[model samples]
Target: MLDVLRVTFPFFALVLCGYLAARWRLLPLEAIGGLNAFVLYFALPAMLYEFGAGTPLGQMLDPVAFTVYLACALLMVAGTVRFSLNERIRWNDAAFGALVAAFPNTGFMGVPLLVALLGATAAGPAILTILIDLVITSSLCIALSRLDGADEHGASAAARKALRGMALNPMPWSIALGALSSGLGVRPIQPVMATISLLAAAASPVALFTIGSVLARSQIVAAAAEHGPMPARDFVPVAVAKLLVHPLLVLAAGQAAIALGLPLDRFTLSVMVLVAALPSASNVSLLAERFEADNGRIARIILLTTAAAFLTFSAAVALVGPRG
Candidate 1:
């Protein structure tokens, strides 16, 4: 346990520091916005490219693991919708409720933490999971929310928009390029690799701190004012699905994969499981606000789940390297 603490403490400390900085307004909120841009547009894409490019395409793109991830995401979304309907949730409320239950903070938090804890190699699975989360889970959330809005044109328009967005997204493109490089056996010179390393190194902390800044600005009280009642009682179930049930299901699926004689490294699988366990994304809160869909409830959920992830992450690490 003490050993686990040593590995986990530093990462949590960084988040704590960011939260404190935000709470104190030590940095302007706009600083976070700039940092977020640098991370998203530059550092993160470079990191993804280098990591994705460097990985053996065969291992990183395993069909079975990918299938398991997709299945888990689909099941969670379906379960959330069913539960929401049974509880008499309205359309927007149910949409946001399902959103909370489905999406993970795979980009802002997952990339950095995976690189730190599991190394560049582990990043392959994290990146894969991020793709799954973003492309599939995110699109589903948008569709459900639009349906609730009674927007007939939304489904088709949103599909086209999502396809275009994904096609143009730098990180995903970088991943595609990287896989191509790996497949073609194109290794860069040492000096070029060094530059990629430098960019990748800057990705995690900047992203994490920027996320903290965003979290700081979330006005839970104000969001509540606009989005009907606060729905405090309804929150627990969403939190459970996000912070508990989802991860456990992923873990079980991973274990089954392992039992099937899959050639997966335990460390890689652990990275996937941990990334899968992350809370409802901060972006979900932003989207909820944009669509006028219960931002306060979303904020509360993001805050609670992110805080809970610290302990959950430690447990995940212990599961992976209990003796380390």
Candidate 2:
């Protein structure tokens, strides 16, 4: 619909701009990391903090929404792992594939864009999705990745490392502080709030642009590398799982929850579905490279879902969107 397009076009256009800029060397690939660091370390945390602090803890995250979304993510992980693991592939590749299929780019893209489309209140559910992905889904997938040939030490080590990384992550900490502030009625002083406001305002455009640049950089790197034969089967199905299947699972599960008489917020359910509809988390490519999985396949899936989400995600927004 024209109405939906009007809401989504600029966000996707910024993504295209970032993609073009990186491809054209306007944003050198080396510099993409720094831009991402800025968003991750500064802009995004502040944005989450403000949203968390301003919202009532109840509205900040719906328990029913969390359970439903988590269940959907777990289901996606299991399903993708089952589907992707075949003759050649092992748990490492399939686990990361499952991760890509389960994790959406909620922090970098979904929070800001969804809030813009739906309003500030959407931030609670959007941020809640980030917590689920970072804390549970990613950790579960990475732990599963080591299941191929690892001893108990290696497996436990991988899980510990994952939890440690989550502890170091600033986004979750900011969300907690924000919730604490909300809980205790602790409002910030004018200047501090103003700084957070500015950073939060910058979060959307910068994060979106960085997502485009990261996708471009990944593609550039993958193309330059000595990539092995990547059949469409290896990547395409996983990409489809991310852009299409994940959201559908969320929708179906949430609807079922509502039928079961759970207290799921209608707007929260819509936000959760849209968040699930977002492309595979771009950072999954980095995780793949880190764990020595097939980065080529992971990057392709991220790129494919991101590019396709321009259409699929828009349609999803229109379908579940509040305005509609």
Candidate 3:
């Protein structure tokens, strides 16, 4: 319907324009990196602080919904790994594949879409979803790194590495600090809050646009070199899990939350489902590249799923229906 397209088109348009500009050599590809850094470090944190500070944290923090979401994600990861292993894919590939399939584009795609379609009131669930993605779901990426041959660092070293990796992540820092400030009732200076609001306001459009450019780049780079097809042989099982199984599990989990009579607001439920429906995080490719996983193959999957998201996400929204 027009309502859905109205919500979606601007986001997609921004991305399309950014991608074309990048392809035409009008914008440096490195700008995407810089933009991502700015959004994560400054813009998104400010947004979280401002938005989270006003939310009734007690109301939104539903243990039932949280548990259900995490359980569903973990189950999907386990199932994907098992299926990939059965298919004879390397353990590392299976792990990475599981991660890519399980993780959603929550920060980049879910937040903005929820904001536009659902409104500012939706920020509570959107921010919470971002925290979950950065803190919990992304941790799976680190686990996958181990499976992918990132050296057999001891458990302590692995713990240290995961901690170090998490420390540098601006999303978690922002959310943790923001949540604490909210809980503690710390009020930022009005002017400072305003400045942060400005930056945060720009975060979604800029980040999503850059993601579009990055996806275009992924497709281009993936094409010139023949590493294998997108739905790669080894990655097929993972893709199937991502495109099908994960969402089903999330739906079941969400329905359970509904049945439990949790106090989730309309926006919160909507955003949570949206996060559940998102395609793979763009960060998966970044993680694969950093850990020296099959970067080429992962790049293709990112593009493929991102494009596939147009359908999957719409279907999810339709299935979940409008929030109560």
For all candidates in order, the CA lDDT equals: 0.73, 0.89, 0.69
Model 1, C-alpha of 194: deviation from truth (Å): 4.1
Give the TM-scores of the predictions, in the order they appear: 0.87, 0.96, 0.87
Ranking by TM-score: 2, 3, 1
Provide the RMSD of all predictions against the true structure, rounded to 1 decimal. Answer: 2.9, 1.4, 2.7
Candidate 1 regions with alpha-carbon error over 4 angstroms: 86-89, 187-194, 220-229, 257-268, 321-324
Model 3's alpha-carbon lDDT is: 0.69
Lowest lDDT sum, 10 consecutive residues, model 3, at: 147-156
Q: Model 2, which residues run further than 4 Å from truth? A: none
Candidate 2 pairs with clashing backbones: none
Instruction: Quote the positional error of residue 162 for candidate 1 in Å.
Output: 2.7
Winning candidate number (TM-score): 2
Query: Would you list the clashing residue pairs of candidate 3?
Result: none
- Summarize candidate 1's per-residue lDDT along 63-138 as a digit string, tens digits: 7768878888888888887787644465566677777777788776776666666666776787788788767876
